[model samples]
Target: MGRIVAKVTVANPVDKSKSRTFDALVDTGASMLTLPTNWKKDLGDLAETRIAKVEFADQNIREIEICGPVSIQIEGFQKIFSEVAFLEMNTSDGMYEPLIGYIPLEQSGILVDMLGHRLKAAKYLDLK
Candidate 1:
């Protein structure tokens, strides 16, 4: 089986004036938008904080504070005030940066093309 990757956009919305946008893979299995720890500070400091525990694939659970209002944009749609997870690791590498998971996708009402590896407006998919 080959690897499946979905391209998505993540932005720091705290400083709307200097907001930054970057692309990342869409991990459908992920529950929230995951970003590099630095992004939390880069977006002009943490906006909000919440106490939550995240479980990893290996059954390892880590306590995390989700700070956000981080915005997510995809295929011309944008979801403002999107809640995201401030992960411990920086995923900014070649072809892989951070991830926009099902959270924003559901909020924006977009459909994931599992085989095509692309995003389409949910309305488009609804017609099919």
Candidate 2:
């Protein structure tokens, strides 16, 4: 398997007018979208909050803050994620860019092509 990357846009659901575009790592190992703590201001005021326990590959666990609903755009699709975690770790700790995880990938109907190192839309069965 290879690393899948995509260009994504993150915005404040409350005010879509406020948003930022950037490249994000598409990580299936992650369950939720994660943005750098510095993006807090650009994401606008968070209306809700949650605590998430993140387990690293080394079996280390850490609790982090989650806030949303955030509007995320990928390719031509868009969805409002109810919660997004703000990574408090420093850039040196490998938290350099945003991460698009499984939740948003499934919600946005994005399919990962590992061999191609790209993302494609998941096809839905047309019952009609």
Candidate 3:
């Protein structure tokens, strides 16, 4: 298996001035954009909030804070509208570990090149 990571910029749709760009893990298993709760505050005010039950890799299902209406842009890709999940995760090495889910990738028409460990823009989005 290979790891896919990319630099992602997340900004509140209402206020694009407040944004953050950093390296994030491309996780196909993740249902949506997941960021550390610490950064959520910097995004200013989001449009809405929701609670979702997420099953972690440990097999424990827990409720999570999901905030949204943000613009997600991967370097060299068009921005896409999507919600974000504020999660409680600790990085032992003191680094930001945001996870980019499949939703934004599909929405942006970007595909993960696991073999090349890069992102490829699709010529056409699938209807099926």
Candidate 4:
């Protein structure tokens, strides 16, 4: 599968007025959204904090800081989730600043097209 990248907007859940847009890597392997630790200031007053154990591809586990209840927006869909993780990355590598994970994609009804390296809204099945 090719890399899928998209622009994402993150806002403070309490005050929707505060928000920031950044490029994010759409990671199917990841379970939750993660942003840089420096973005905490822009996010403004994260409502919660906890330690999260993250295992990388090589099976290296690390305890990282997680903060929460931020609003995430992609394409035209948006949702205020209860939690998001934060970690530091090497800016020199030119990697995407934020990582959009599976949970957010599922929550926002987004479908990933690996062959096209893009994202699309999932169609809901209407039984009614």
Best by lDDT: 3
Q: Encode model 3's per-residue lDDT on 60-118: one tens digit a residue.
A: 99888988888899888988888899888878888978888888888989988888888
Best by TM-score: 3
Tens-digit lDDT track of model 4 for 25-49: 8988888888887778887888657
| Number of the candidate with higher TM-score, 1 or 4 | 4
lDDT on C-alpha atoms for all candidate structures: 0.67, 0.79, 0.88, 0.80
**Residues 1-128 of candidate 2: C-alpha lDDT, one tens digit per residue:** 66777888888877887888888888888888888888788777886587878897789898888987888887676565657888775767664767888888888878888878888777972335
Q: Which parts of model 2 have CA positions greater than 4 angstroms off?
A: 93-95, 125-128
Give model 2's TM-score versus the native structure. Answer: 0.85
Cα lDDT tens digits for candidate 1, 30-101: 888777666665567656678788888889898766876766666577565677787777345533357777
Model 1 collision count: 0
Model 1 regions more than 4 Å off: 1-14, 90-96, 124-128
In candidate 3, position 69 carries an lDDT of: 87
Lowest-lDDT window of 10 residues in candidate 2?
119-128
Error of 4 at 51 (Å): 0.9
Pick by lDDT: 1 or 3, better one: 3
Off by over 4 Å in 4: 93-96, 125-128
Per-residue error at 95 for model 1, in Å?
Answer: 8.8
